[model samples]
Target: MLYKLWRSFIKEIFLLKRDIGGIVIIFVMPLLLIITITLIQDSTFRNLEGAKIPIIFIDNDHSEVSQNIKKELEGSKTFRLLTNFNEKTAQDAVFSGEYQMAIVIPENLTKDLNANVDSKVQTIVSSFGLEADSAQAQKKAPKAKELHLYFDPATNAGFKSSVMNSVNKMVFEIENKKIYKAFQEQLGTTEDIEENKNLISFKEITPLKGEKEIIPNSVQHNVPAWTLFAIFFIVVPLSINLVKEKSQGTSVRARISPTPYFVHILGKTFTYLIICIIQFLLMVAVGVFLFPYFNLPAFDVSGNMLSLIVVTLFAGLAAIGFGILLGTLAETQEQSAPFGATSVVVLAAIGGIWVPVFLMPEFMQHIAGFSPMNWGLNAYYDIILRHSSISQVSKELFLLFLFYIAMVAISIFYERKQNAV
Candidate 1:
């Protein structure tokens, strides 16, 4: 009986053999997506590197201090000075992509600083307002005050970070001069205290720790997220095959034959399982060969063998089982396709696939815990990033095992009901 069932399953694989071209397309999709997104991300990185970060100066003061501030920036490597001081010209330059930001040293900037008074620096980046992504654009306004040091907001952390280092150094130099002068006068020494009088120097100012590393290859993030999505989408083709077999009366014929109904269903499951395995292998191969980012290591903290086996087994089981359950529940291609696609997208978005959970709201982060993406990602992190063993992921592995069991149970029940009539 087992031999017959195995033969039947092998027969089914060839019976509804998928179009070679279609299989090729499906297998290639993930790799193509990886390549395209990686290119875009790399291009953005390149554009940000050598391309000039242009800033327009609007100095309303026309004073020595304001001019000095302008020179200080133009002399530094942080920005290129675009010669558009007026608001209209600078705004136009920004909108036209000729400049990234504008620095407005408001009227009487020097007078305010020298007098120990408060003043505001007006920084403008494209009229579209601040791109939360561009630290350079958001910082031009604050860099305006680095020349005088006292009036800067110090609120924008990046701007404050760089400014603070310069300010610390300047303060130390000033204090050293004062100390040297006092000592020289007291000792009646003729030594010069003009240039080299350096006092307490800032060794290093560490920026805030745990700043999220920017993903250089966006595909590293996108590919895994979208692959999960495509796996969900595979349910459409699977379900359509089921319904098609039923409509053509082949399923009824199989039921009446020596093959048990369960064996017939097993055949269908095998078909999809083979396809999925092939899809996985092809995607991984392409990622490793073409993309240079495939085969993210499995987490393994302790040297335990059994735990690692369990984690991989349960994860694969859950993913495949979910695909099967979704296929069984769907009645038609049109109905299944959209649902499958949308479900993947929604689940990925919620699961911290697109944007990491840390960036999401507190409530959303909690909600993401329920998604398979979260479980999958956590498992991946444990294996790939954390180097954890399967036993270390007992909670996640168990949850996936349970999910697989539930899905299989539901599929069996549903198929039985449909066959009973």
Candidate 2:
């Protein structure tokens, strides 16, 4: 039985080696995807980190308070201050896509603040020129001393929120200082104000178990995700080969001989398992070695190496088991090829291979938990991102093994029923 399985495995390996396209699809395509996606993501993150939010500042108030606010904005690295313009010019610049936002400090801001009256500033945003006709047609617009904010409708929501938060913080500080000064004037004491200067503070906390580290970049994510995607793709070729053998009466020929049906299945599974492991190692090698050469982040594994190996082995088994099931169910090469290819794509989509599971809706997230790709991704993340120990990934390992077992059992049951008939 062992000799028969070995021979069958060797035959599959030889057959695969002769097929150039299959080899390229299994090996080269995944590396290309990982590199391409990682580079794009890295560039985007770098741009975001270095980007400065541009804002046009029109300080019509021109008072001590307004000047101070202008100086503060200019000093902030988060904002690029464009101060050489009035309200109309600033509004036009924003409309022409020259800036993302605009701010106007209303006249009598200092007087209103000093008198303890509610004060407002005017902010004008471009609105991406959506209502340009209506805005231009208005012959006379009422002048109000209120904070008028104008924003480009096409601007990213997160970027807009960040700019708003920073501006609001500055406004809060300015108002709080005015109130504090008023209190000092009424009470005739600066000692109380100085004593309560630090009434609020903030601290950051990490939810992971290990020492907090910088979050892994796109290379880390793409390498593992595309690696698993490539592994699952092995089903297509495996199914096609199995369908060809059945159509050619190879299975019948083997059954008439001394070789058992289980040996044939085991042989094919082992061959693909070897291929999966090789594909995974190659992808990881690209991350660790090739990525750093191009100045991208390297794949640094801080967790137990043994744990990574264990998880990877089970992941391979699960993928191979799935391929075997596809092979057993497929009647013809044409039927099996599309089913195998499309099923892997669907699995990758729902399993968080293409997108992070957290980004999915709550219901989709719940469904993703049932996907083998989800288990594989979680296992990889545990080892690579979380730096977890062997014990930490025991549950993922167990679930992966259970999935592999279930797939193999289903495949065998179907094969036996066909044989009995």
Candidate 3:
């Protein structure tokens, strides 16, 4: 019985039936999609480099502290500071796309800074995750004052590199004696030091070993997440393939064989599941070996690789079950293809498959929690981003395991319903 089931599973996979174009659609198309979408996102982000994000600075206090703050804006690479103008005109510029951010230093700014008070910086940023055109129009009218940043979160490396460069430039202007004296006071050192010793101490302020790891937030977060998203689109074409088999009378013929219905489905699923694994490895290879700047941290290749592979395979199985359920319900591939594909695509967007959910709106984050992609991503996040132990991912693992069970149940019910007809 075991040998028969195994042979039947193998037969279902080879299809023993021929459709050259169907194989191409199932296997080849997903590869193209992964490549195309990755390229498009890369190009779009690169294009944003040329965008001129304007910034208006309002200095209500005409003091040196206010002037120094203005100088800070002048020194920043993210903002092109506009001249001081009335509140109405400054606000109007944000609407006109002449500025994307506005900073207003209140009349008490100098006093606050001098007194070392923790005063709030009144920053007028564009609304949260709104469309640019809408933001532009709303800026013309009075919108709630929300603090938006001119530095693009999508582009900036958490302002780390830029900040380091700015520090290098600013250091030339700083009084070296002030820092040394402060250090001496903190260390309880003698007030007088030899001239040669002072010179040597000045040169010793270079960066310490491994200090470069201090700041993060770069393309690393986006690249792996988005690459997996493109791979997830594979469910669409694979679902269409299954639907085609049904319409063509192939599935019925296979079902009547000695094989159990589940075994037959498993074979076709395994083929595409293997496809996903290959694509995942390809993306990982490109990320770690090809692009250092965009690379994800090296994955654990020890015992963890096998567990990771199993986790990823279960995710593919869930997708396959969803595909089959959709395929069996629809009368034709034309109807089923769009239904499955559109649903996955939309779910991917909501599930933080493209961008981190933390970066999205609170509502969207809540919505993403309902998606299987979110569980898969969270699993990946635990392993890759947080460097979690297997035990540490218990919550994500349990949720995904439950999702797999639910999908299998649904697939079984859908299959029985289809067979009844």
Candidate 4:
């Protein structure tokens, strides 16, 4: 049985060696994919964090409130304000996609803001028995004040949300400061109340491993993701080859041989699984060694190398099982190749490879939970980013192993049924 499996593996290897294109797809293309995608994403992250987003800012109020807003926005170091164009020009620019969005401060904003604050202050003072005249305390409020935000049609919801939140927070702070000053004035206070800058501070933290703090960058997140992409991509060639063998009568010849059917399955699974491991290693190597040359952060799996390999092995088996299932189910190269490739892409899309599952809609996120690729990716994240132990990643590993079993079982059942017929 061992010799039979060895012979089957040798046959598969020989056939693979003859197909130069398959070798390129298995190795070269995945390397290119990881490199290209990591570089693009890394640059985007750097730009978002380090490079200032240009925003067309129009301060129509030309007063303390608007000026303070401008000062706060600039101080955040997240935005680079463009104050050159008028509202019309800025709107046109934003619409034309020259900029992301435009902020238009309503005219008399300072005056309106002051009026609203003063009315509230007067009402509060009268409540405290400070005001002698009830008529004076009932200060008439101004008209509804509007702050206009003109966004580009192409702006994503996240960008719009971020802009709105930043602007609103600044406006809220300004209004509160004005009210505080009024309160002090009304009470005959001498010293201005010092604002508590650290009243509500936020610090983003990623999971830490004993002594090492992992600041996740593109390379660390992407290597495992695209590696799984490349692993599952083997389905295309694996399925097509199975169809080719059937078309060329190879499966018929193998069926009548002394070797058991499991040998053939094992043969292909081992061959492809080895290829998957190689693909993963190459991707990690590129991330660790080549990324620094391009000024990108290095991928570090120092403490979790064993865990990474264990998770990757299970992921490889899952991918191999899927490939075999596709190969067995598909009847022709035309049927297998395109379907295999499309299914991989679809899986990648919903599996948190193309987009993070957290970024998806609620329904899509639930659906992503079922994707085998998602299980594998989460396992990879555990080992590399989260530095989790094998026991910690057992759930994902179990899910991946279960997926592999299900795929292989379905393929075997279908094959046995067809043979009986």
TM-scores for all candidates? 0.66, 0.82, 0.63, 0.94
> For model 2, how big is the CA root-mean-square deviation?
9.2
Which stretches of model 1 miss by more than 4 angstroms? Answer: 20-22, 61-78, 91-100, 117-223, 254-271, 292-316
Task: Give the alpha carbon lDDT tens digit for every residue of 1-421 in model 4.
Answer: 8888889899889888988877898899999999899889988888889989899889899999999999998888688999998988998999999999889999999999998888888898887877534664577888977778989999998889988998898899899988989888878887746644647789887666677675778888889999999988888888878888888889878878888788899998888888887888898899889999989988887877788888888898888888899989989888888898899999999999998999999999999999989999999988777667999989999999899889989988888787774
Residue runs of model 3 more than 4 Å from their true location after superposition: 1-54, 57-65, 84-92, 102-219, 292-304, 359-364
Q: Give the number of colliding residue pairs in candidate 4.
A: 0
lDDT of 1 by residue, 385-405 (tens): 455676778788778778877
User: What CA RMSD would candidate 4 show?
Assistant: 2.0
Clashing pairs in 1: 298-383, 299-383, 300-387, 300-388, 301-387, 301-388
On the 0 to 100 scale, the lDDT of residue 165 in model 3 is: 60
CA lDDT, every prediction? 0.58, 0.78, 0.58, 0.87
User: How would you encode candidate 2's per-residue C-alpha lDDT over 199-316 as one tens digit per residue?
Assistant: 6798765445457555667887888798889888888788777777789888789778887777887898789888988898898889888999888988876545567667778888
When 3 and 4 are scored with TM-score, the better candidate is 4
Pairs that collide in candidate 4 are none
Q: Going through the candidates in order, what is the number of backbone clashes in each?
A: 6, 8, 1, 0
> Cα RMSDs of all predictions?
11.7, 9.2, 13.3, 2.0
Quote model 3's TM-score.
0.63
lDDT of 4 at 323: 86
